[model samples]
Target: MAKKVIPLTNTQVKQAKAQDKEYILSDGDGLQLKIKTTGSKTWVFKYSKPFTKKRSNIGFGVYPEVSLAQAREKRKNARELLAQDIDPKTYKDEQQLKQQEIHSNTLQVVAENWFSIKQSSISPNYAKDIWRSMELHIFPSLGKYPVASLTAPVVIAVLKKVAKEGNLETVRRLAQRLNEVMTFAVNTGLIHANSLSGIRAAFEKPAVKHMATIKPEELPELMQTLNASNLQIVTRALIEWQLHTMTRSNESAKAEWSEIDLDKKLWIIPAERMKMKREHVIPLTKQMISILSVLSSFKRPYCPYLFPSNRDPKKHINTETVNKVLRRIGYHNRLVAHGFRALASTTLNEQEFNPDVIEAALAHVDKNTVRKAYNRAEYLKHRTELMTWWSEHIEECAKGSLSVTASVVNAKFG
Candidate 1:
């Protein structure tokens, strides 16, 4: 037969006094009040743990601090847990540990973790910009908050404020970067889902603006200005190399001699140096080879780069070197170093060259993963012919002649 329990009253609990030794007074079920010799009273709940059938006692706090009614409520809730075969003490401990984890893993902490992994796959400059954006826009406001507590509304409000300031572009980047961090959190098990995925829709998209560049017909005049300009030999060579190869500013600036294969007439940029994180092969043309030859004359013997920095022989020239040179030569706002790629793309497409080959030469990867894999080496042959034609066309544009012999083109543009 089950033993019957008589619940205690408020008056009896209030008037109860501690004896010489500690003793307990039962309320009902698993609830009891233990009064110590020091007059301290604590509410204890005794129960047989589920599965193990082992007896355990858990405290609901002290007497006046946890009033009889409050203790009774806790007892009721605990009984429900026990009825479902969940040990109340283990449940409480697990909940406490989760709360501690939430408090410890702040957004900034997790972002730092995600960035450490992300930086290896991107350029150093880009990595700096990402961290700087977070520091300026995000970390100041919400960095200290736990990632788990980062609800969509709270994050959207932050982005909306940035949007209202006419920094729509910044807001766009912030949204993208924040989404990455949140998605990283999800993947790392710090959070369950990325609730902030839709935050980008809360702001207006920035207007598309192509890089500024002169018309293809103006290449001769620009080349004339470049030739007349009193620029350093290495800087001019850097600009010409980038222009001829149709490579990005940083990619050209950071070029290493080892990446060039003179025998095969190929410059193979490793996956790490490329923007899309894929290896790019540029068919070195006659003009590109000439630029390399010019750079080779003054190249430091110990330097691995074709265009080493003037101030630091160990490092390559600044990525902005060509842009500054362009501005100095009166092409400010008229042309940028990046404008070289656009100029090349426009000229090739206009010349009726294969668009896919041109895109491949430009190092633009196909969006389709499977097709991209198949096409990586597919366009090399077509690209070789296309590069030769483009180099010849550039020679014609420079010489202002209809036909250019190999020797004459090499002598003039090379």
Candidate 2:
């Protein structure tokens, strides 16, 4: 009941031994104020709430920091709060929780906010890819760890886990990218550290395992087999399109009929879908036009897709369909769908075309300034010529000509 109020005058407080000068003040019925050696006093409320039923001591404030009159007022307030069935100790803990929440909503939270804000600026495909890597790999591991707590060892652990898989190259690349994300967070003053730079040198890298492309001479037979295979019509058309237009698999896999202008004899790959992040226009050869012509015999129009699936007929060709077919035809490990472009590049170079012209045909940037300055034609003429020769070459292999094999082309390119 705390009815006793022991107050010490300044002289008595000074006279008492340092250890003996404890002054206790009783605030009404339930609150007690205790004065310490340094002349500071605080209000303590001793009580028990529900559940555990253990006694709790809550400090209101220091003496003078909470003056006598203020202390009495607080005691009355505390008693009123207690009467209302609220535990003062629990109420104070709830307040501390709120204050902690406010501080936590700072730079680290702001970094995530910025990432979301900048997401729309990038292509949706890239955004999804990056977000996936962050969510699956980065966030699960460190999302709740404060950005300030981020360090080299922590970041290295995330990458080493990926490196343990056979994809050493991708692990290396993602490690570099993650560091960039962390550096970006730091530039915003969220992490105050660029952990990427510190850990970049520490990650052990594996030697590159280059996948060999089909020899050029060998490509003619391969192409002939692909063209004649009883594969799905969409699959056949896509293969012919790759050979004729020399476009990437993903670019052609997601091709919309609208991206192709039969009358204009062109295929315009949007910047978002292109790995180089630039609009690429491919000059369609007569062979390519024929392939598209066969594909358009389906139900979908110029709006949805040129190569919509047969089963659903509402969706574009699954990106993996080409690789799946390659495996089906026994080129699983030796030749991939992407190998078609590499084979075409080598063949085109062997056919005595200019290097820049061939690169332009592949929609690659020319390194020479002089060549690039006036090289806007994008090899439409040469690409057309190359496609005609390429199609005929594939036909020669279908006829089983001994002179045309992948081995011969391999020697030429090699």
Candidate 3:
């Protein structure tokens, strides 16, 4: 044990240097001498705890920082905390309580606010998709987990389960949504960083797939088979646009007439309505342009959507309508409308286009931050050529199917 001393100085240092475990300082009354240890010289009140006057260490930091003069002042503050029965070491929690009392957002309550802020920036369909993923995959198990605890391991485990369940597409989409949500949390000062920041290292992505597109050779038969079925023309056309434009099914279904500029030969999907959150400019092939011109009479050019629902003219087409049509055409279990996007990606790659060009045409988000940080260019030239070829392939298949149907009908009549 050492006697504690106040205001270390040249004279005091000389005297204290001779021995360890020796500290000297006067008590608050300035009458009693204080004693401390060299190894751990924690300050303690010989009296009761701060709020109750029960004796305990009244932490006043270490020796030099809390001089004899300062330590006594802290002792008085400890007495103040004592009057309220609050522990001195628990001061940090008190400050946090104060922060909360002032209405600062915490990890526990920011998700819904984050959702509301983002909904308008995303397509209503995408907003719906995000909610579904959150509700099913995350909300039940993790909705209450502090956002701060959503480390890469936790997120990876969730996504890996989805991938293992043969829902690889959903695994990727969920990862994307998680990344966006945490990013919002960061921008709003809720958490310091995105929880999915190192997600790539935490989980291996499922095998990259070329779209399981029906082959051009197989497509003619499939098309003929589909054409003769009882499918709504709008639903059929919705699926038709998906193939011709190589666009995502939801994108085609939710198309707004106002987004198309026939004179410019472009269809500009606003960033807020797109998954990538960047406006995409797609060149329209002559065939696609012609299809729009014909449908334009039935769809007012200034209406809410190019494919507005017949049942609700002001609303965009239903997200599931095209898929229902596919299921009815007997491709339900075998092929999904979403699979069509992959199909185009796969088929076009086999035709020898560069990989990046094919990806951009499909509106895949850039996973490479370095590329996004530096490159400002998009794959316009390749997408133009890509879309043109895609339209030709679809139209050719539809014609083959029409020919087959005509032949069948003629035989039936005879």
Candidate 4:
């Protein structure tokens, strides 16, 4: 025989008072309102595990907060689970864990995790730039969303906004990073696929603008203007050294005293510093040696960098310092610091220097892996000769007497 069961009503639950001992008011089908001696009222669903027949109580919530109607609805759902042989408490726990997983696998959280794993492999400067890009573009909009919730349309909207702002290059880079983060999420099982994998073609392509450079005939005027500028002697020498060696602005700016060999007339840049991640040997010409000698005379005794910063002798000059100098000389977009490489490559090739030697001097990696491995020091002698001729040619260009007839160039280098 079973005790008579009456469904709970809001009026009865509200008027119920706690007694000396805790007691339960049953509403049938395992739903009960528990009144504690402390005057607390809670709604609980009592049930038995299907396999073991072990009794378990699952709290729906506190009464008054979870009204009679809401408590009854919760109990009905729990009964459905029990009928299917599922423990309601276990089901609740599994649901909570799923919610926790969704929160943990958010786009921003997973992107940061991926960045931590990748930062160790890249340069500190490069890593800083990568983080800056994300902070400026990606995190604010999509950070809180779970990686699985990010769709192709959602990502395209973000990138399209950046492209519309005329920062197409930033858009391109952000697209690449967004793809990388989403791909990381997929690889880590946070999502099923990378939604941004094919999103690049949807944005506008940025126009290409090559670095501005002077024509060969204009080198004399440009050199004279640089010499006559009110720039400091050290800065002037740094510019001259760059022109003579044809090194990138950062390579010239970050140069160290130890990398130079005056005796051998060489500058050996380490693998860590070289853009190609391999050591490069520059054959220093007489003019380059002269510029280095002048710089050495001004070197601070405690500074290890060849071109120490003016404000802080312990640190190298700002990587933009040389470019700023170029801009200061009224050549802002007309010529840039990196333009010297183009100037050299163009003039040297025009003078019939061997293209392979010129490319090797530029420290460009050979595309073919087998050739790259064998040709790391290829055409060393020819490059040395080319540098000497280039130095002499620069002097002639400065003197306004450089004659470049095809026959003259062919006979001289051939």
* Candidate 4: tens digits of C-alpha lDDT, residues 1-414: 888898877788999998999999988888999999988999988889889999889999997899988998998999899899988899999999987998778888998999998787777888899999888888888888888788889988887788888999898888889888988988888878787798889887778889999898888887777655777666776777777788888789899999998887899998788776778888988777766766766587789898888899899888888789989988888899889889999999999977777777787753243244335355556778988888777777656322222112333422
**Candidate 3 has what TM-score?**
0.58
Screening candidate 4 with a backbone cut-off below 3 angstroms (N, C-alpha, C), the clashing residue pairs are none
RMSD values for the candidates in order, in angstroms, are 3.6, 11.8, 11.8, 6.5
Would you list the rank order by TM-score, best first? 1, 4, 2, 3
Q: Point out the higher-scoring one by lDDT: 3 or 4.
A: 4
TM-score of each: 0.89, 0.66, 0.58, 0.75
lDDT of 4 at 230: 76
Question: Please, what are the lDDT tens digits per residue for candidate 1 over residues 150-226?
Answer: 98899988888888889999998999999999999999898999989998887778987789898999988887787
Who is ahead in TM-score, 1 or 4? 1
Off by over 4 Å in 1: 1-4, 15-19, 366-378, 400-414
Off by over 4 Å in 4: 1-53, 57-88, 351-357, 366-379, 400-414
Error of 4 at 406 (Å): 28
* Global lDDT scores for all candidate models: 0.85, 0.66, 0.65, 0.81
| Top lDDT hit | 1
Q: Compared to the true structure, candidate 2 yields what TM-score?
A: 0.66
Identify the runs in model 3 with alpha carbons over 4 angstroms from their true place.
1-107, 116-121, 128-212, 301-304, 365-382, 400-414
Locate the minimum summed-lDDT window of 10 residues in model 1: 400-409
